[model samples]
Structures are given as structure tokens and as C-alpha cells.
Target: MRVFVAGATGVIGSRLVPLLLSTGHDVIGLARSQDAGAGLERLGADVVHADALDHAAMRHAVRVAAPDAVVHLLTAIPARIDPRRLSRDFAQTNRLRTQGTINLVDAAAQTGAKRVITLGSASVYEPNGPDPATEDVPFWHRPPKEFIPVLDALRELEALTAEAGGLVLRVGHLYGPGTIYARNGSFLHQVQSRNVPIVGQGTGTFSFTHIDDAARAIVAALETTADGALNVVDDEPAQVGEWLPVLADLLDVPPPVHIPVQMARSAFGSWGVAFMTELRGADNTNAKRVLDWSPKYPSWRQGFEAELAHPGSP
Candidate 1:
């Protein structure tokens, strides 16, 4: 199979290219810079230089690749995000999710691609309520704030891909070498700096995924052509209390200071609080059953250790 990976320079894209190549697929990647193309070339992927937001360029690149499958990993995160403004801010990423997904899906159709697979987030689910949420759970029940626009874009992208052949994977809070999940720099960055405080008794249990697992599950869907939403996650679904001290321990930092849930809500708003302390974990039975995919790292602790060592796995 010939595969074209958009956003080939991203955290997942860098790892995904080699995985597709190892499987005997002729891989082509979208790169916007000479440096980005150089990296993809080193990984044995044919480079297609174009901006994903540029529909015409993206369409042309896809047509040129003439791929059997198209994987969408494009995001504006690298260009805009910094340590100062982290995941707490997501409006630009939201635009990339909604509008960028629409454009990429359209480009896939124009290129006559057979399958389309997108990287989605477990954050799409409501923060409170039942643990271990499934793909069939309703999405619009929550207020239209944090996860709605992104999931709405995902729904639109899925609808468009279904017209061809499509799979949308809702991945958990991402962790890996190059991602926000690894290193004390991300969530731990806040914790270490004492910028983060425990809210609501630290009761919310959230889903998380290793970066390699995320890249692999997405490509697995592309290879197998299994359609619909598959929750990509690790074996462990953790509560805030359970993971916080563990993470702080890993970084050799102090435990997060606790704050009242209402105070936290008033300070960060519902979306921000839910993201930091939420209880939505996604079930991965469908992905394991259909795509023959299982996470190499059973939990974030094991995954994070390996990730901090590798620096190249992301």
C-alpha cells in the first residue's frame, strides 16, 4: 500500500512514517520546510512539501502521491504553542481541528484516496460522570466549550471520510518523548512550578496514551480500514490522586497543592478544570479487536520512563 501522511513533521507523524515504511508501504509525507523534508527523507519517506491549510497545495501533493491511504496528523501546534501557553489554551488548535480537517478530507477525496484516518482525543468526552466511556457515548450532551469544536470537526471529518473510507480514533491524553505527556515539562511543568493545584479532592480519573501507541493505532486503522470511532488508550485509567504523586515522584518534585473544586473552576473555567482534573476514560476493546492493536506501554508510568530515555520515539 502507498500511504501519504499529512503533518509528517509532527510528534506522531515523525514516528508514523517509519512504521508505514516497515510494513512495505511506499510512504510520502507532507512537509512545509526544507528541514522537515530532510527529516522525512532520512526516515525513507518521499517528501511532499505543502501546508495542510493550503487546500490547493495539499490536494496537489495528495494527487501526486496517489496513495492507497491518507493519514491526517496535521495541526498548528508547533508553529504557535510554547511553554508559556500550554494545552490550557486550545482555540487555534480547535480551528485546525475543524476547518483543517474539512480541507484535508476534501483533499483526500480529490486525490482518489481509498481510506482516511484521523487522530482524535479522549478529551472529547465530558469530564464528569461514568468512568470508562465508550465510543457509543453521546458527545453533544456537554456544553460547547472544550472538546466540542474539535469533536465536531472530527464528526465532520468522519462524515466526509465515510463517503470514501474512514476511521476516526479518539486517543487519550497524549504522552511520549516529544509530546506533552512525557518529561516534567508538561503537566509536571505546572506541578513543579507549583502553578498547578489539585482541585475537587483529586477524584477525577482520566484516560491517557503513550505516544508510540497513538501513532501505531492510527496507522493500524489506516492499514485495516476499520471505520468509526476507536478509543486508543493504555491499560491504566487513572484518577488525579493516583497519578499526581506518582508523576511528582518521577520528577522528584513535591505533590501538587490541593485547591477547592469550586475555586479551581472559578479560576480556570469548566474546560480548563476538566482537562486538568477529569474522569473521562475511553474503552479500547474495539481497537484491540478490530485493528489487532495493543499498547506497548501498559500505563503512563512505564511509558514515561522509557520516553524520557528515548527522546527519539515521538
Candidate 2:
């Protein structure tokens, strides 16, 4: 199969191109810069220069690739977030999820692409529901003010993909070499410096995924005829109170301090407070069954120890 990938220079895309190539698939990556094009070339992927938001350019690029499958990985999320300015930070990413998806899906349809796969967020599920949210669970009915627009964008993204009979991989919090959870990434800096604190009971649950596993799942989805959505997460769902302290311990840093919910809201905004207190974890049963894929690091505990604690130690 000839695969066309948008956001080909991104964390997952960089890893995915090589995987697709190794599996004997011809990969064509959309790049916005010469540097990114060069990088994709080094990975043995053909490069097409086009911005995902530019409908004309994106359509032309996809048509030129004439791909059998299209994979959308476009996003502009920052390494570190400013809680107070959450909406501002996510504005571009929201655009990418909305318009970027439209452009790609439309192009795929034009070129008769058979399979279309795009990324989604597992965290969008309503937190008030079950402990482990499934694909059947609805998106948050009452999300935080900052997240309302984000969820709206996600809804648009998923709806568009589903209309095209494509698969939406709602990935969990990604942690690997290029993600914020990497050893030297911004998330670790926040942990090592004791910047992130536990809010209230810290009852919120988090489902995590290794970067390699995320790429593998995409590869699996390419061969499967499964449409609709799948929650691509790990086996274990951990609470904030449990994982934060464990991560601090692994990094030999001070445990996160606990603060009241009110203080947390003032410090980290409503979304931040809700994230630490009310967020629910996602279940990956559907994803595993649909794609016939399993995570390499089945738990964040093993992922953190291997990637964050002892990277390249052998």
C-alpha cells in the first residue's frame, strides 16, 4: 500500500513513517518546511510540501501521492501548557483537528483512498461516568470552559472521519522519546521541580500509552477494516495521587504537594483543577480487539521506568 501522512514530522509521524516503510508500504509524507522534508527523506519517505490547513495545497498533495491510505497526525500542542491561557494554547490545534481533518478526508475521497485513519483524544470522555470509559461513553456533557471549544473541535474531527468510513484512534496520554513525558521533556522538568501538585483528593484517573505502541496501533489499523473509533490506551488506569508520587520517586524528586481544590483552581484554572480531580480513564478493549494490537509497555509504571528513569542504559 502507498500511504500518505499529514504532519509527517510530528512525534508519532516520525516514528510511523519508518514503521510503514519497513512493512513494505510506500510512504509519502506532507511536510511544511525543508528541514522537515529533509528529515522525512532521511527516513526513506517521499515528501510533499503542503500546509494541512490549505485546502488547495493539501488536495493537490494527496492527489499527487495517489495513496491507498491516508493518515492524519496534524497537531500543534505545546510542550508545556499555561493553565490560565489554555484556550489560546489550543486554538491552533483545534483548527488543525477541524479544518485539517476536513481537508485530508475530502482529498482522500477525491483520490479514492481506501483507508483513512486520524488521531483523537481519549481524555475527552465525560469524567462523571464509569471508572474506565469505553468507546460507547459520550464526550463530556459539561466540560470546563477552556475545554468546550476543544471538545467541539474533536466532535467535528470525529464526525468528519466517520462520515468517510475512517477509523479514529482516541489515544491516551502519550509518553515516549518525543512527548512531554520523555526523560528530558517538559513534563519531567515540572515533576523534578515540584511544579505539579495534587489537587484535593487527586481522584482523577489517567490512561497512558507509549509512543511506539501508538505507532504500532496505527499500523495495525491500516490493515483492519474497522471503522468508527477505538480507545488506544494501556492496561492500567492510575489515579493522579498514585502516579504523581510514583513518578517523583522514580526521578528521585520530592513528592508533589497536596492543595485544596479552591487553591488549585486559582493556580491552575478550572480545567487544570478538573483534570486533576475529575478526569476519567479510557478502556482499550475495543482497540485491542479491533486492531489485534497490544501495547509494548502495558503499564505506565513500566514505561516510565524504562523511558524516563533509565533511557539508553541497556
Candidate 3:
């Protein structure tokens, strides 16, 4: 199989390119910068340079690669996120998810690409829904005000992928060497500084994905005929109250402090409060069955430990 990947040097893509190559797939990666292109070349992948949002450039890149499958893992999320300015911070990423997706899908169709796979988010589901959300659950009907645009972009991305008979893998919070959950990552820094406090009850649950596991799922998706959406999360779904303390303990930091919902909203903003109190976890049953994939670190507990033990490993 010949595979073309956008966001080829990103957190997931860096890991994904190696997996794709090891699986005997000929890979061509789109790198937006010279350094990124050089990195892709070092990974034994053919490199193409193009801005995903530039329709002409992207179309030309894909046509040149003429891949059998196209995988879109493009995103521009910052290392440290400001909960108060969620929409503003995510504006460029929203465009990537929307227009970037449109350009890629159009390019794939033009070049007769047989498969299209795009990344989606577990967080886009209604935060008040069932504990472990399945593929059938509707997206957030009333998401936090600040997250409206982010959610809208995700919805559009998924709808577009589905329209193209592609698969949208709704992955959970990705944690690995270079992700936010890493030792030198923003989340760890916040925890060490006692900044990420628990809101009332801390009921919001999270389903996490190891970067390697996510990369493997993408490889599985490439080989399978499954279409539509799948929640590519690990086995365990833990609440903020459950995971935060454990993460703190693992990092040898003080456990997160608890605060009232109102205090949290005032301190961290509405989306942050919803994230700590109302967000629901996603289920991976469908992904497991459809993609024949299972996460190596079945729980965040194991993943956290492994990441800490091997600080810079993927």
C-alpha cells in the first residue's frame, strides 16, 4: 500500500510514519517545513511539502504522491492551553480541521485514493452523556460556550470524512513521549505547580490513548474495510478524581486540591470547569472489534508509569 500522511512530523505522525513503514507500506508524508520534510526523509518516507489549507498546493502534492490511501492527522494545538481562550486559541486548528480537511478529501478524490482516514476527538461528544460514550451518541448539544467553535470544527471534520466514505477515529487524550502528559510537558508542569485543581466532585471521566497505540490503530484502519467512526481509546475510563491523584503521585507531586464548581469556573473558565466536572469518557469496543486493535497500555496507570520510567521513549 502507498500511504500519504499530512501532519507527517506531528506528535502522532512521527510515531505513525515508522509503524506504517514497518508494516511494509510505502509512505509519502506532507511536511510543511524543510526541517519536517528532512525528518520524514530520515524516517524512510518520501517527503512532499504543502500547506494543508492551501487547496492548490495540497491537491498537487497528493496527485504527485498518488497514494492508495491518505491519512489526515493534522492539528496545531499548542503545548499549553488556556482554558479561558479556548476558541481563540483553537482558531487555526479549527481551520485545519475544516478547510484543511476539505482540501485533502478533495485531493484524495481527484487522485482516486481508495482510503481516507482522519483524526477526530472523544471530547467532542456531549459531556453529559453516558459514562462511556459509544459511536452512536450524538455530539455535544450544549457544549461550553468557549468550546463551540472547536466542537463545530470537529463535527464538520467527521461529517466530511463520513461523506467521503472515510473513517474518523475519535481518539482519546493522547499521552506519550512528546505529548502533554510527558515529563517535560505542560500538563506535568501544571501539576507540579499545583495549577490543575479538581472541581466539585471531579466527576468528569477521561479515556486516554498512548501515542504508539494510536499509531497502531491508524495502521489497522489502513488495512481494514471499516468506515464511519470508532473511539480509539484504551481499556480504562477514569474520572478526573481518579486519574489526577494517581498522576500526581507518579510524578511525586502533591495531589491536586479540590475546589467548588463556582471557584473553578471563576479560576479556570467554563470549559475548564466542564472538563473537570461534566466531560464523559469514550468506549473503544467498536474500535477493538472493527480495527482488531487493543491498546498496549490498557490503563492510564500503566501508561503513566511507563512514560515516567522511560522519559524520552515512544
Candidate 4:
């Protein structure tokens, strides 16, 4: 199969390209800059230089590539976490998810592409009580103000993909090489500096996906005919209090400091506090069952240790 990947130089796309190549698929990677294009070239992917937000460029590129499938991996994330900058930092990514997604889907539809695999977030799911969130669960109808745009964009992106008979992988909090959860990533730096803290009872559940595992899932999606959304999370869903200390231990840092819920809300805003206190974990049962995929690292505990050992791995 021939595949065209948007955000080909991104955290997941970078890893995914090699996997697709190794599996005997020809790849065309969309790059926004000379350096990104060069990087994809080094990976043996034919490069298409165009920003994802440029609808005309995307349509032309996809039509030129004439791939059997298109994969959307575009995202813009801040280097560091700043609760105050949430809205500003997410604005570009929101645009990418909304406008970029539409462009990619339209390009695929126009080019007669058969498969479209796009990334979605598990965070869009409403809290699912004690259970992990399945694809059937309702989305947060009334999300926090800062998150409303993000969720709205996600919904639009997923809807467009599903309507086109494409697949949407609702991935969990990613944590591996080139991601914020990496050894030298901002999250680690914050934990080492005691900047991120445990809030309230720290009971909010988090489902994690290693970069390698995520790439594997995308590769698997290429061969499967599954449509709509499927959760691509690991086996274990951990609480903030549960994972923070373990991550601190892995980083050789002191356990995270505890703050009152109100203090955390004041410091990190309502969204951040909600992440630590109310968010639910994503269940990957459908992905495993439908795509015949399983994560190599099914727990953050094992994934974090491996990441620390390797420092930087693709």
C-alpha cells in the first residue's frame, strides 16, 4: 500500500514512517520545512512540503501522492506546560485539528483514497465513574471553557473521518521518545523541579500509550477496515497519586508535593485540576479486538522505566 502521512515529522509520525516502510508500504510524508522534509527523506519517505493548514497545498499533495490511504498526525503542542497559557497554546492545534483535518479528509475523498486514519484524544470522553471509558461513552457535553474549543475540534475531526469511512484512533496520553513524557521532556523536568504536584486526593485516572505502541497501532489500522473511533490505550489505568510517585521514583526525584484541590485549581486552572481529579481512563478493548493489536508496553510503569533506560529511542 502507498500511504501519505500528514505531520510526518511529528512525534508519532516520525516513528510510524519507518514501521510502514519496514512493512513493505511506500510512504509519502508531508513536511512543513526543509529540515522536516530532509528528515523524512532520510527515513526513505517521499516528501511533500506543505503545511497541513494549507488546504490547497494539502489537496494538491494528496492528489499528487495518490496514496492508497492518508494518515493525519498533525498537532502543535507547547514545549512546556503553563496552565495560564492553555488557551493560547492550544489555539493553533485546535485549528489544525479542525481545519487541517477537514483538508486532509477532503483530499483523501477527492483522491479516491480508501483508508484514512486520524488521531483523536481519549480526554474528550466524559468521566465514566469507576470504569475506563469505551468508545460508546458520551463526550463531555459541557467541558471547561478552555477545553471547549479543543473538544469541539476533535468532534468535528472525528465526524469528518467517520463520514468518509475513515478510522479515528482515540489515543491516550502519549508518553515515550519525542513526547512530553520522555526522559528529557518538559514533564520530566517539571517533576524533577517539583513544579507539578498532586492535587486533592489525586484520583483522576490516566491511560498512557508509548510512542512505539502508538505507531504499531497506526500500522495495524492500515490493514483493518474498522471505521469510527477505537481507543488505543494500555492495559492499566492509573491515578495521579498512583503514577506520580512511581514516575518520580523512576526519575530519581522526590515524590510530588500535595496541594489542596482549591490551591491546585488556583494555580493550574480548572482544566488542570479536573485532569488531576476528574478525568477518566480510556479502554483499548475495541482496538485490540477489532484491529488485532496489542501494546508492547501495556503499563506506564514498564514504559517509563524503558524510556529512562534508552533516554531517546524512536
Candidate 5:
């Protein structure tokens, strides 16, 4: 299969490129910079220089690549993205999800692409909603105030992707060695350096996945021609309270000091506070059954420990 990957140098993209190459699939990755292209080149991928927002350029790039399967890995969040700007930057990110997705799907359709697989997020779900949200679970538009509009945009993006038989992957929070959350110690840095303080009871449940595992799921779905929304998460959902101190221990740092949610909200604002204080998790049954997938890491703790040992992490 010939695969075209947008954001081919990103956290998941970096891992994905090599996986596709090893699978004997020809890959053409979209690179926004020469440095980004370099990684793809080294990974044995043909590189296409084009931004996701530029539809005309993207159209040409896709046409030239003529991929049998188009994988949309494009996202605004980088390995070092600021947590404070999530709400502000996510509006444009939402545009990328809605409009950029439309562009990618349309371009794929024009190029006679067989399948389209795009990344989605579990953050759109409400804080403290369900234990494990399924593909059949109802997504509350009013929940997770900061990410609400973004979820709405995903709804829009999925509607468009559905028109062209593209698959929408609603994955949990991505934390791995190459990701912003892990790079340069990242959230792990804050924890190791005693920077990420605990809030309230810190019992809010959440989910996570390894970048490689995410790539595997995407590849599996593409290979099987699986369509619609699937939750690409781990075997178990973990709570902040339990995971934090464990993570701290792993980094040889002190256990985090707890602060009230109200106080933390006043400090980190609603966007940060919601994820830290409130929680949403996803189920992986559909992915296992349909995509024939299984996560290499069963939970965040296991994944992070391995990633922390990796060279890229601090």
C-alpha cells in the first residue's frame, strides 16, 4: 500500500513512518520544514512540502504522491507545546480538524485513495463523565468547556470524513518519549522538578497511549479498512492521584503536593484545571475487535516508564 502521512515528523508520525516502511508500504509524508522532512527521509519516506492549511498545495502534493491510503496526522500541538495556550491555540487547531480534514479527505478522494485515517482526541469528552467512553457513548457537547468547540469541530470533521469513508480515531491523551508531554522531561519534567502540583483529591480518571501503539492502531485500522470513530487507548484507565506519585517515584521526585481544584483553577485557569481536576476515559474494545489491535503498553504508567528510559526523554 502507498500511504501519505501529514505531520509525518510529529510524535506519532515519527513512529508511524518507520512502521509503514517496515510493513512494505510506500510512504509519502507531508513536511512543513526541511528539518521535519529530514526525519521522514531518514525513515525512508518520500517527503512532500506542504502545510495542512494550504488546500491547493496539499491537493497537488497528494496527487503527486498518489497514495492508496492517506493518513492525516497533522496537528498544531508540537512536542513542546505550552499547556496554557491550549484553549487559545486549539481554536485554530479546531479549524485544522474541520477544514484541514475536509481538504485532506477531498484530496484523497480526488487521488483515488482507498482509505483515510485521521487522528481524533478523547479530551473532547466531559470531565468526570463516563468510566470508559465507547464509540457508541454519547459525546456531550457542553462538557469540557475549554475543548467543547474543538469537539464540535471533530464532529464536523467526522461528518466530512464519513462522506468519503475516512476513519476517525478518538484517541486518549498521548504521552511518550518523543511527545511534548515527555520531551525535555515535559510534564514529567514538572513532576521530576516538583513543578506539576497536585489539585483536589487528584482522583480524576483518565487514559493514555504510547505513540508507537497509536501508530500501530492507525496502521491496523487502515489495513483492515475500518471506518468511523474508534477509541485508541490502553487496556486500563488510570487516576491522577495514583499515577502522579507513581510517576514521581519513577523520576525519583517527591510526591506532588495537593491543592484544591478551586485554587488550581484560579492558578492554571479552567483549561488546565479541567484535565487535572475533572476526568474522561475511553474504552479500547472496538479497536481490538475491529482493528485487531492491542496496545504495547497496557496503561499510562507502563508506557511512561518505558518512554522515560528512551533517549529522547529527559
Candidate 6:
């Protein structure tokens, strides 16, 4: 299969290009800069220099590539985030999820692409649920204001993808080399700096995925005819209190400090507190059954160790 990947130089796309090439797929990647284009060429992907936000250019590129499948991995998240500026920080990424997805999907459709796969976040699910969220669960009816754009963009992206018979992989909190959860990454720094504190009961559960596992799921999606949404998370869904100390241990850092719920809200805003105290985990059972995909790092516990062992891992 010939595949065109937007965000080809991104965290997941960088890993995915080599994997796709190894699997006998001809890959074409969108590159916005000369360096990115050169890097993709080095990795054996034919490079198309275009930004995902440029609809006309993307359509032209896709038409030129004439790929059998299109993959969207575009996002603009920074390596580090200040909790107080969550909404400001996510504005560009929100646009990428909503507008960038629209452009890519449209481009793919225009080019007669048969299949499309795009990334989605599991964090859009509602909070404090007893059961982990399956793909069928509804998004939060009233998400915090700061997260409204993020959720709205995801909804739009998913709707567009589903209408086009594309696959939307609702991935979990990603942790691995080049991800925020890496030893040298933002989350680790936050932990080391004591900015990521355990709040209240610290009961909000999160599903996690290693970068390699997430990329593998993308590879699996390419072959499967499964359309619409699938949750691509690991086996375990753990609470903040459960994972934080373990993460601290893996990084050889002190356990995260505890804060009262009110203090957390004041410090990190309501969204941050909600994420720590109420967000639900994702269930990946359907992905495993339908895509025949299983996570290489089935749990963050083992994933963390592997991440730390890798030299200069993100």
C-alpha cells in the first residue's frame, strides 16, 4: 500500500515511517521545511513539502502522491506546559485537531484515498466514572471551559473521519521515547519540580500507551477495514495516586507532593484538578479484538523502565 502521512516529522510519524517502509509500504510524508523533507527522504519516505494547514497544497500533494491510505498525526503540543496556561497552550493544537484534520481528510477524499487513520485523545471522555470508558461512551457533557475547544475539535475531527469512513484511534496518554512521559520530557520535569502534585483522593484514572505501541496500532489500522473510532490504550487503567509514585520511583525522584483539592484547583485551574481527581480511563479491548493489536508496553510500569533505559529518550 502507498501511504501519505501528514505530520511525518512528528513524534509518532517519525517512528511510523520506518515501520511502514519495513512492512513493504511505500510512504510519502508531508514536510514543511527542508530539514524535515531531507529527514523523511533519509528514512525512505518520498517527501512532499507542504504544511497541513494549507488546504490547497495538501490536496495537491495528496493528489500527486495518490496514496492508497492517508494518515493524520498532526498536532502542535509543546514539550512542556504550564498548568495555568493550559487553554493558551492548546490553542494551536486545537486548530490542528479541528481544522488540520478537516483539511487532511478533505484532501484524502479528493485524491480517492481508500482509507484514513487519525489520532484522537482519550481525555475527552467524562470524569469520575466507575467503569473505564469504551469507544462507545459519550464525551463529557460539560467539560471545563479551558478544555472546551479541545473537546469540540475532537468531536469535529471524529465526525468528519466517520462520515468519510476513516478510522479514529482514540489514543491514551502517550508515554515513551519522544513523548512527554520520557525521562527528559516535560512530565518528568514536572514531577521533578513538584509541579504535578497528587490532588485530593488522586483517584482520576488514566490509560497510557507507549509511543511504539501507539505507532504499531497505526500500522494495524492500515490493514484493518475497521472504520469509525477505536480506543488504543494499554491493559491497565490506573489512578493518579497509583501511577505517580511508581513514576517517581522509576525516575528515582521523590514521590509527588499532595495538595488539597481546592489548592490544586487554585494552582492548576479546574481542568487540571479535574484531570487529577475525576478523569476516566480508556479501555482498549475492542482495539485488541478488532485490530489484532496488543501493546508492547502493556503497562506504564514496564514502559517507564524501558523509557529510562533508552539514552536521550524524550
Deviation in angstroms for 279 in model 5? 1.7
Candidate 5 colliding pairs: 79-180, 185-189
Q: On lDDT, who's better, 2 or 6?
A: 2
TM-score of each: 0.89, 0.98, 0.98, 0.97, 0.92, 0.97
Alpha-carbon runs more than 4 Å astray in model 2: none
Displacement of the residue 62 alpha carbon in candidate 2, Å:
0.4
The residue-by-residue lDDT of candidate 3 on 195-234, one tens digit each, is 9888998899899999899999999999998899999999
Per-model C-alpha lDDT, please? 0.73, 0.92, 0.92, 0.89, 0.80, 0.87
- Summed over model 5, clashes come to 2
List the candidates ranked by lDDT, beginning with the highest: 3, 2, 4, 6, 5, 1
Candidate 6 lDDT tens digits, 261-312 = 9988888888888888888999889999999999998887777777775655
Task: Encode model 2's per-residue lDDT on 155-225: one tens digit a residue.
Answer: 99999999999999999999888888888789889988899999998898999988788899999999999
By TM-score, how accurate is candidate 1?
0.89
* Shift of residue 222 alpha carbon in model 2, Å: 0.3
Instruction: Please give, for residues 101-164, the per-residue lDDT of candidate 5 as tens digits.
Output: 8889989999999999988876556556546777776666455456667668888888887888
Candidate 1, 1-314: lDDT as tens digits: 88888877787887788888888889999888999899889988898887777778877888888888888887665432332234435555666666667777788788787888887766566557666877877664664355555556666666765665688888887776566555634655666777767777777677788767887887678657588778899878888877877777666678878888678877767755665566577778888999999999878778766765455443
Clashes of 2: 0
TM-score of 5: 0.92
Candidate 5 off by > 4 Å: 78-85, 309-314
* Residue 244 in model 4: lDDT: 95
Q: Over all chains combined, what TM-score does candidate 3 have?
A: 0.98
